[model samples]
Structures are given as C-alpha cells and as structure tokens.
Target: MSTSMAENATKKLTLKSGDDELFEVEETVALQSQTIKHMIDEQWLGDVIPLPNVTGKILSKVIEYCRRHAGAGAGSGDASTSKSEDELVLATTTSGDDLKAFDADFVKVDRCTLFDLILAAHYLNIRTLMDLTFQTAADMMKKLTVEEVRTMFNIENDFTKEEEEKIQQEHPSAFK
Candidate 1:
C-alpha cells in the first residue's frame, strides 16, 4: 500500500470481552461510548480495552450497534460524505424508518440476551443503546401481571404479604 493510503486508514481499537473474545472496532465507532471515550482520553491505549462486565455475545451486538450508528452519524452529528446524490436523497427520506426497523429487529432476542444488552449498555455509558434496551424491556412488561413479570425475569417475590397488599392497594390499576 502507498504511504498516504496507510496514513489515512481508520485507526482500530481492540476490545476484550469478559469471555476472552477480542473485537477489532474503529476508533470512531468505539468512541460512541462515553466510558470508552474517557478511557481513551486518559491514555488507556493499552493492548486491549478490557470489558469485564460484557459477555462476548452482548459485546458483539453492542459493537454492531456502534458501527451502524457511527457510520450513520447518529450520536456524533457527522454524516458520511461519500454517498452519491441519489443515495443521499434515499437515506434522507428513509433513515428514520430504516433505523426503527433495525432497532425492532435488534431487540427481538430472548430475555437473557435482552438483560445482557441492558447491562452492557449501562456499563458502556452509551445513552442511545441504554434507552433502546430499556424501552424494549419496558415494552415487554407492558400489560403483564406482576407474577408474570417476575417469572419472566426469574425474580423471586421478596415482598411480604403485607407489603404486597399495600402496593396493590396503592396501585390498584397495576394489579388489575
């Protein structure tokens, strides 16, 4: 490769997940996470950025989200300049619809994966990912019984009978 070509190449960062999986992500993409941005700013440019709280599967999904949004300038406010006029027009017209569809398909995972995504998003401090995962979880809980919600999340009922009765009385519509 030419010297200028190599010089202009996007810099990459290696992220190590809890499961010992390493992912190569562009600096622009990884900087979407405030936690990662701070780490980089503080000279945390070691061999690999250790993400001890994120599993390989969830980290992969998070990287996928970051790559998509980074490419589209979702959080950074810098759109791509390489698109043709027709392509740009198409993206302008359908970007929102396309993103909505992508998000809907992205969150259609099992409960465990959903929770893993929520935890990973929170840890990474990626607001868009956090909001999307939280809203998805909330949508899953809508109109469900308390028992069903607990069962779905594998959460044991820790409230005493009195406490449960008081809560039910306070939020009668929720119970009903």
Candidate 2:
C-alpha cells in the first residue's frame, strides 16, 4: 500500500461513551468490534460512534484490549509459520505470553466493573473480550460455595428450609 493510502486506512475513529467521553482509536483497532465494523461498512461515518450502554471506564478498558490484540498480530497466522527458532521465541515472548499476562491482569477488577466489562464487550460484539470477561466471572463462581455466591451477588435465597434440605439431600456432593 502507498504511504498516503496506508495513512488514510489508519485513520482514527472517535468513540463516544455513555458518559459522553470521546476516545480516539485507530480504525484497525476499532474494527475488532463487529458492531463498529458493521456500522463502518454501512457508511455510518457521522462524527463519533455513540456507545450509550458503556461507561467511560469500561469503554476505555475495552478499547485497550482491542488495541493490544490488534497490535499483537492476532488472527494474522500461526506464530510458528515460516519463522526461525529465534524468531518464534521472540514472537512468543512478545505476543503470546504478554497477551496472556495482560488478560489475567485485565480481569482482576471488582465485581461491578467485571460485569460492566462483560456487558460492554457483548454490546460491542467483541467476542474475545466477552469470552475473557465471562471466563473470569465463571472462575470466580467456581471458587465459591453456593451460599457464598448468593451473598456475593446479593441474591435472595427464596428456598424454604425444607426445600433447601431436600435439595442438599438429593445433591450431597454439591452441598459439600
């Protein structure tokens, strides 16, 4: 691609969050969101893309994830394709391991923030981000007992004592 054409292709997009904060992101990075890509393909280039369901904080995080994944050569090809041993090592260090570490840290947020991220990722049609956030939530639940899960999520237990006992009796392994 010519320099001018590449520059034009890399043009930045403005994303407006629910709080009315505007984020400038590269077209390639923003294209990671299927929703945004579809809107762009449909010729919706009128100023900023409004994300009415995403708060500024969660939107920022989502953009960060998109930017990282886009820049890391994700979906390009397998890292082992036509590369020397040293090149493969370097590629794994820079992309694979770093992205994994970033993902781990990214999900280390409060419950409210995590849920907001999940919702934003879903709304944006970012499958990878949605999966990461959902897996994090599932991991949290997996480590908690039923009572603990209810307490953490502020869920009211409507089951009567008799019903609860019956359930426990039927599923003794689950109660433990």
Candidate 3:
C-alpha cells in the first residue's frame, strides 16, 4: 500500500450526534457504518457528519462498539472469503473468544439502553451491531409470557375479553 493511502485510511472524521455532541473517530472505524461511508463517498460533508437519529449517549456506545470491532480486525471489506458458515464459526470459536466476551459485555446494559443501541445500530446500518443488539433483546424475551413480553416493551393490550378468548381458543397451542 502507498503511504498516502495509509494516511488516508487513518484520517479522522468528526461525528455529530443528534444532541450535538461531537466525536472524532478514525476513517476505518467510522466506515464500519455504511451510512457514514455513504455520506463520505457521495459528498465530503465538511468537518462533521451529522447523525440526527442517534443521540449523543447512544452514538458514544456505537462508536465504542465500532472501535472495538475494528480493532479486532473486523471490517466490511472482507466479503470475498471462501469459508463456509461452519468454518467461520469454528475459526471464531477457536481464536475469537476475547472478542466474543467483549461483545457479551458490551450488550449488558439496561433495557432502555439496549433498545437505544438497537435503534442507533439500525439507523447507522451497522449490521453486526444490529444483530448483537437484536439477539440480546431476543434472549431477554425468551421464556417470558405474552403479557410479560408486552409489559417489557410497554405495549398495551387492545383486545376485548371475548376477542382474546376467541383468539386463544382458535390458537390454544400458541397461547400455551
């Protein structure tokens, strides 16, 4: 690689969150989000790239996630691998236990923060972060009852008693 290319790869980009907090991150780290990469590619948006959908708190967490993953050598440029799913799994399991542990600890925040992370990950188009946050939420929901799940997400029950009974009767197995 050329010296200029290496310098460009390490160039820092300023990210401005919705709450107007600014963060400076490396080019490779910021490129983990396809949204930011698209913005940089289409137009160099001056000194700061604005992310209106993500708050400062959530944006910080997202930057932490990106930096850790990028430092672990994960990147969006490795789409040409010939390894199968099983092979990849085996490789990661054998060599990436520390990264796995880091991911586990990263998602151990409260439900509200987890949800915020999910929203930020989705809006930024960070696929791996989305998967991690989603899987964490799914794991939290497992073994919970319908009412418990609804309550956890602050969803209200809108069905009348008779409607609920009839639906349950029609799909008893689902209710179980």
Candidate 4:
C-alpha cells in the first residue's frame, strides 16, 4: 500500500478518562483534538493517553463529536482549515448545514453536562466543539433575565438590593 493509503487507514488510540474508563478511537478522530495530538507527539505515549481533567461521560461525548467531524471531512482533504475557533465556527456553520444540525442536537444536554462538555472541549483544544458548546450556552442565556440566568446557572445574587436597583436603572432593557 502507498503512504497515503497507510495514513488513511484506521489507526486506533486508547484514551483513559479521569474516571478510569477507556475508549479506543480512530487516530483521525482523536487527532481532531490538539491536546491529544500533542500528547502523541511530545511523549512516548503508552497504550493509553490519560486525560486527567475529563470524566468518562464527557470524553465519550467529545469522541462522538470528533468522530462525526472527522468522518465528515474525510477524503475531501480541504486545506482551508481556519486558524481560530471563532473563524472556524463561522466557516463551518455556513458550509455544512448537516453539521450545524448535528451540533444543535449534540448540545441539547442538561446544563451540567453541557458545561462539562464545554470544559472538556476546551481542555482538549477542540475549537469547534468549544465554539458549539459556548454558542449553545449563549443561546440558552440570551433571552433570559439576569435573575433567570442566575437561577439557571445556580449563581448567587451577590449584589445588594440598592446595587441591583442601580444596575436595573442603568440598564433597564437588561432587567426587562
């Protein structure tokens, strides 16, 4: 087989999540994460790459996202990959409506799980995943009042009544 053929072949990497769960994924899928790619490059990685910051559930979701994306771009060999997450997300959202739909459904988890996926994606340096999760969070909070947003995130109301009133007065539209 040719070198390109060999490179395209399904190579597997084992990942060990923080909760001790193990996953075997294609190298193409795992390489979607710069963190995992760097781990593979910077060390004589053993059989398993350990992700100490991510739990199994989050890791599983990350892998699913990576697998879907890698499969989407397979064989196309498009060299116009974006450098920044903001640009990449914008570019991707315009180009692939199917992927956009997938991303919309993918982020429909409960708040805690969505936040966990965001942290895991950030840690993994998967910019697309990070952007998707962040956008989902922003979408969830966009139409909500400050109090409703606080309640959604379980954040305490730290400001005094007078301070709150001052803020409401200053930004009446935000309060409404």
Residue-level lDDT of model 4, residues 59-163, one tens digit each, is: 999988886687556434442231223323434554477877888889989989999998999999999998899998898888899889989878999999999
Candidate 1 stretches with Cα past 4 Å from truth are: 1-9, 74-94, 153-170
CA lDDT, candidate 2, residue 116: 93
lDDT of each: 0.80, 0.82, 0.81, 0.80
lDDT value, candidate 1, whole model = 0.80
Which of the predicted structures, 3 or 4, would earn the higher lDDT when compared with the native? Answer: 3
Q: Tens digit of lDDT per residue, candidate 3, span 1-176?
A: 55665466457889999999999887767888999989989987488999999999999999988876765553224521423333334345443777799899999999899999999999999999999999999988876877998889789999999999999999987565
Off-target runs (Cα >4 Å) in candidate 3 are 74-94, 170-176
Tell me each candidate's TM-score.
0.80, 0.84, 0.81, 0.82
Candidates, ranked, lDDT: 2, 3, 1, 4
Global local distance difference test of model 4: 0.80
lDDT of 2 by residue, 5-86 (tens): 5465457889999999999987767888999999999999589999899999889999888867765653356422333333
**Candidate 3 lDDT score at position 92:** 52
- Model 2 TM-score, all chains together: 0.84
Colliding residue pairs in candidate 4: none
User: C-alpha displacement of 114 in model 3, angstroms?
Assistant: 0.4
Best by lDDT, which number?
A: 2
* Model 2 regions more than 4 Å off: 1-4, 74-93
lDDT: worst 10-residue window of model 2: 79-88
Can you give the lDDT of residue 66 in candidate 3? 86
lDDT of 3 at 72: 59
